[model samples]
Target: MIEIKNLSHSFYVGKKGKEREIPVLNGISLEISQGEIASIFGKSGSGKSTLLNLISGFMKPGSGRILINGEDVTSFSEKQWAAFRLQNFGFIFQNFQLIPSLSTFDNVALPLVLEGVHASQRKLRVQEILQRVGLLEQANHFPNELSGGQQQRVSIARALILNPQIILADEPTGSLDSETEKEILNLIRELNRQQGITFFIITHDEEVAEISDKRFYLHDGALVNGGVSIEV
Candidate 1:
């Protein structure tokens, strides 16, 4: 569950000696229910990723309140944010951000390792999630040996290995072919349906938006619907 109230963000642009605030989000307010699949569509530089970063604690909001499951996290310290993210959120990226050198098993085990999980337990958990993502047989393979879809599956397994309550995916299907994208999207939907994991996906793909339970578009740092059809 997520609750955002009157959220706003901006960045300083221009020369170092002379900068001005360039607002990205203005008075954003929205709530995402548990287990719901939600998509936010927007053009380039429309602040879609900004909102995700704000929610995930990658960057603090300039001004506003962000509550996860009823706890306000607006002022959380860096240490607190790190702990909270590890315990509550999983992240998937467009590029499938896996280490080129790490084997699939090791890649998926990174989170557990960071948490100081024992070797045996980490192996078991990694195996389980790899199997769930249909990557069990490729456990020992390196990123370079796998296809794009397979690589993305590895990323998905890594994210799901911790069983976090929410998954924040940015452009999840961006790099895959259309057919592969369909498979990945289906996998995401299946995971949401079977595991009840909430998905907050920011994507420019209409096909991705179609699979979501709720869809909204971002325009000039604000959310809008019913008038201009969201191309993204």
Candidate 2:
């Protein structure tokens, strides 16, 4: 389980010489189980991304503790977070974040390369993930050559390649058309059901929220209506 307790964060923004602390998340607490699919809905600047960053260990919270499976990770160092992320978390974003210069296969294999996996092993893993995402035929194609849905598929493949326990998605369907968005949602659901991977998705769309087992709304720096039931 992932447990967040009284988490609060703020940013200093203003003139270079004078800045004030602008609160983002204020006394937020939540929990996600091992294989649950949860969605947090928020408007722009609602601290949705900030929450994800803190949970993923990309940023430290100003207060409170983040516990994953009974381990406190709030105070982890950068090096520790790096190793931890590689072992436990995967990330997906609206922009896809694929390398334009590299082929789909190479893009998905980048994480394994960082882990010092051998070339042969990386190839096998990348191939398996690509096939799982239904993108094996496009492995040699560059990002620019694929459709938007296909590109997102590559991004999903890359995320799953590491076999992480949790997948953090920020507005995952923000750039897709309705049909493509449905396809992506179905893919996410299938993966979660089959692989038992947990998903913590942040979005503004009701469609995305409908697919979640638990739903949350972030308002005024606090999470409201968390774990509420929504008609799927």
Clashes of each: 0, 0
- The C-alpha stretches of model 1 lying farther than 4 A from their native spots are 15-17, 225-232
Local accuracy of candidate 1 as per-residue lDDT tens digits, 147-211: 99999999999889889999999999999999999999999999999999999999888889998
Error of 1 at 72 (Å): 0.3
Q: On a 0 to 100 scale, what is the lDDT of residue 17 in model 1?
A: 86
**TM-score for every candidate vs. truth?**
0.95, 0.95
Error of 2 at 6 (Å): 0.6
Report lDDT (CA) for all predictions.
0.91, 0.91
How large is the C-alpha RMSD of every model relative to the true structure? 2.5, 1.7
Residues 38-119, candidate 2, lDDT per residue (tens digit)? 9888888899989999998889999999998899999999999999989998888899999999999999999999999999
Question: C-alpha displacement of 141 in model 1, angstroms?
Answer: 0.4
Off by over 4 Å in 2: 15-18, 225-232
